[model samples]
Target: MEVAKILHMVGGVGETSYALNSTLQKKAMHIAKPIVQQSISQLYCKLQPTESLTIADLGCSCGPTTFITISEIMDEIYEVCHRLSCQVPELTFFLNDLPGNDFNSIFKYLPTYDKMVKKEKGSKYAPYYVVGVPGSFYGRLLPEESIHFVHSSYSLHWLSQVPRGLEDDSGAPVNRGNIYIDDTSPPAVIKSYVAQFKQDFSTFLSLRSKEIVSGGQMVITSLGRSDVDPLGGEVNCLYGLLAKALNSLVSEGVVDKEKVDAFDLPLYAPAIEEVKELVQNEGSFEFYQAKVFELNWDPFDDQMDDFVADSFVSGENAMKTIRAVMEPMLANHFGGAVMDALFSRYAMNVAEHLKKEKTKYVNFTVALTKRG
Candidate 1:
């Protein structure tokens, strides 16, 4: 099914889609700092030709965050070049993501980058060019062995498509009363999502490995869990929240209670161990670093509170908003009945929770390098 159709069926993009790029800025450059530093270090230590250097930001959404990431990466590269008394390479950076992504917004910000680069060298200067590439990162998006450094944030955890059985008879099994379970919900569910992630990630690694220079490095950050168990509690908690939200809609008559009760969520957030397994199984890369940190929302407490308020002040309003937000996600993940109650409950809970505390989570970032 088309991405649009999937989204429409599930409901619509909800608070999750709210200014996504802007929110990501809260995550630091430190997690991926080593890879950026290493790539530059390799260029200098190996006396690699600067003319061949290239960097890419996969899933580069349009916003100040993208620019910030690019700036930090370039600075890291420049530091290495400076230490070696070498002129910076002719840099060609690729900004890539889904075809529907906002290319215009990204390009609009490009000219400013040119101006900013000049400020770096003062009287000195370096040549850097950036272009936007539109495509799914699941397949080969670049020429073989053409890139030197790559980075992706909050993208890999997304399955290319929702697994087939997600909306099938097993839907309720994936939902534990008040909450929803993730791809790792049950042994069976875990198998389903793991199989999908394995396939998607394998393709991702194979394609990226071919494009990345032998010594090139990459850092990818995703919504990750702390355990490998398909039935882990954290997984259940998140699903439960979403399910609870959906239940609120059902009660309001915006969605048929029966329909809301039947749906199931198709996405999964893997544990650090699972991610490490993916890297090792691909067998082309060496692990350099792995770090997990809690994604905090204390700073955005106000914004989150407002989002909760606007979304679920009443049954009808909440259902309307949820239907719109969930349609696309449902279609993408494959629709099912298990998630209805789970999502409804999530909406109601958010409304209630905002009356008190804030929302927060723990996430992970992993960095790797192909064997030189």
Candidate 2:
């Protein structure tokens, strides 16, 4: 599948839209806020008397979390400017995502966002301007040395495309019956995934190196694995369950098994060591800090004590979240007719899995500065 053409969150503000089902991503942003603040704080401290700043939020899908991130970064910059007794810099914000993303939804909400920023920061607040840039971050999306600070959250795990060569000499899917790397996947499948990640990450760092000025800071947070055991991570379980759901449909002859075999999700969860190694080899950025944290699969569990008892509620929310993000790609590949049945099965599987274990996603946050 051509990821750029097909990959986008379920659009609009309807029941199945990303805008309504993105609490998990919002919680992720909340957890990574401190790292973002620290990165922005250092950027301002290192470059005082800054007259203007340009910021980009990569893979900023349509949602409130996009503006929430902007507000948080601006808050830190405002504080830093106040301490330095300098006027807050005029700001240019870039909200970037795939071309198929719902830019219209985000644009519709911008007037409200501008009003909130003006009221909170005062009408005299340096003009804050936002523009939507549509493209993949795996390549250059901005002019050379245009950005001072860059931030991406809950993205980057998605590869630019599925790794090439997942088929045998006879042209059959090597990783048959699986949508992602799992325990049953062969070594060749694992090797293909790692190779793709290394190449893609190298390209990403290279592109960012040109777009960011020397000494500019970047903070990225994404799903990751904590150990070398690729199949042992919590994310693998989610995919495994999804595979089971698909296989169940295949068994009933409701969906074609060959189609399932041909499909592979373009996602890879790298370990922190892998990221460090790639950045070091790329040689354009120095790692400032890296951290790993776990978030419960159900982000709303904290607000409710009886999540386990209300398994249906938890299951529905989880299903909606996954559907909002994956439906576009899945529908494009598997046909739109299968989505309702597929997710219904997926929800039941998730609910059953929840009863057995409290799965938590491992998230990695890294801060880097361009080498001078």
Candidate 3:
């Protein structure tokens, strides 16, 4: 299957759409906002472009927060200029994602978005334009030195493709009956995933290096693991349960076991040091700040307890979150017939697990400044 062509969140604003179910992603963005603001503020003061400031949001999937992000960025720029007592610059924003992303869903709300902005910014507002760019970030999509600030949130953990070498000399998959890494996975499986991440991330930095001007700033946030073991992170537990759900369907004769064995997620949540090392090796940017943090699987839950109070509701919420981000790819591979049954079992499994012990998603965020 062509992963790029199929790799988009469940589109439209239906009950199951990413627009409604992206609270966890929104939470992560909030956590990273300070870093984003700091980087942009420093860059603006330094360049102080007379005419305009250009910004890009890579992997800018469509949702409520999609436009909210642009609004916030412009608001930040306006606030800083107000304090500095200087002329506010016009702005251009590029929203970039793969071709299959719900760009139309994003475009639908543009008129209302502009009207709201005009009412809010009446006199002090500077004009801004939005353009959608469709392509892979693993390769070049923009011209040289055209971008001044770049912000990517809850992206970059996705590898360009599934890791190779999960199969053996006989062309049999070594990590069978699993969609992702687990405790029983061989050394080959772990090595294949790590190596793929290194290659893809380096390519990403090298491409962005050409597009961003000297002295530009970037803030990137993605799923990450704090554990030294690549296979022992929060993501493993999340996908491992998903594997269990699929295997149950196989046992019930609803899904083919071979299909389960053949599928693997094209994602990796790396250790924080891995990211820092690549930024240094890529030779394009300096890390102003690098940090790791965690959030509950239930986005609305803020309790400090290791055990959740309402496991059933949290389980349901968690399933919606995962379904929004993963349904398209799963349905494409496994056939849409099994989606509803699969996630029903998944929601129950999650509720039982939550009752036992609460699990959180680990994340890493970095603020960067480009070198001359």
For 1-372, candidate 2 gives per-residue lDDT tens digits of 899999999999998899998898998888888999999998888887878899999999998878888899888988888888888888889999989999999999999888888898884488778999999999789999999999999889999999987999988999999999989998899889999999999999999999999999999999998787676667888988899999999999988999999999999999998999999999999999988988766767764333475666777778888999999999998889999999999999988988877677788999999999
In candidate 3, what are the lDDT values of residues 1-372, reduced to their tens digit? 577889999889899899999999998888888888888788888977567999999999998878867987998898889888988899999999999999998888999899999999889878899999999999898999999999888879999999999999998888988888899888999999999999999999999999999988889999999886897788898889899999999999999998888899999999999999999999899999887889998888987579698999999999999999999999999999899999999999889899988999999889988998
Question: Which is the leading candidate under TM-score?
Answer: 3
Give the RMSD in angstroms, all C-alphas superposed, for model 2.
1.7
User: Measured by TM-score, how close is model 3 to the native structure?
Assistant: 0.98
Report the number of backbone clashes for model 1. Answer: 49
Instruction: Please list the C-alpha lDDT of all candidates, in the order they appear.
Output: 0.62, 0.89, 0.90
Please give, for residues 188-252, the per-residue lDDT of candidate 1 as tens digits. 55577678878888888888999998877788877777667756634455455566555566566
Worst 10 residues of 3 by lDDT: 42-51
- Using lDDT as the measure, name the better of candidate 1 and candidate 3: 3
TM-score of each: 0.77, 0.97, 0.98
For model 2, the run of ten residues with the poorest summed lDDT: 302-311
Clash count per candidate: 49, 0, 0
| Candidate 1 Cα deviation (angstroms), residue 120 | 4.0
